[model samples]
Target: MPYSRLKNLWGGTKSLGKLKVIILSHSQQLVEVDELSEACGLEKIDLQGCSSLKSIPHTDQLKNLQLLNLSGCTRIKRTEVEKKIKGLDQEGGLKETKSESMMFSTLAVKLEPGDNTETY
Candidate 1:
């Protein structure tokens, strides 16, 4: 439908070696999907805005992807994410569940507070 934000994005001519995670909140552009898939080498992708994004690209290529946040993304499919999650789960891989999934009141997965400390 709209082709304004997708201009000169997914050309696939860049090498993203240092990227780890990608958070596309309120970015309603489709042209960058492929480019992002190629550039970020992203392990965690948070698509919070794209309500029209129904498909995901290059799942096999993103072997390092762990957590995918699609909280507000109603249009995006869950099967792709589910498949990835299942694969990771089977292999005994670990993922950082977000604050919505778990309630720690401080951190999601003890990112700062270690096990030896008690804040009661």
Candidate 2:
């Protein structure tokens, strides 16, 4: 089911029971980001380059959630992601990983496109 465009499954979904990954890489119009809360078993998610998306709801409740991709989401911010994936670290920041150590110590990675050369 990864990379499948289940546009209607957001609010309609009830459970995913240990589903490890999901991909929504490029979409034309996915405005509501809050409906993802229903999938509590999700571990990784890809919402990269979703232009119409404006915000991501708080996802601290989804404890299994780990990797997140916001590489080209121009409107999203680091603070917004920090606030969403709260409670992962002591100071409430993205966890540091061996491959990519984000600004936070929680299990999160905020991507911003800039001439600075960054991550997702």
Per-residue lDDT value at 116 in model 1: 28
- Assess candidate 1 and give its lDDT: 0.44
What tens digits encode model 2's per-residue C-alpha lDDT throughout 20-115? 677776663665467666567766677765655567756655557656666555555555655665443323344433533233323235322121
Tens-digit lDDT track of model 1 for 1-95: 22234423445377765677766655566423655556435666665545555555544555565555444444443344443232332222223
Instruction: Please report, in order, the local distance difference test score of every candidate based on alpha carbons.
Output: 0.44, 0.54
Q: Could you list the CA RMSD of all candidates, in the order they appear?
A: 10.2, 10.3
Shift in Å, residue 12, candidate 2:
3.5
Could you give me the TM-score of model 2 versus the true structure? 0.59
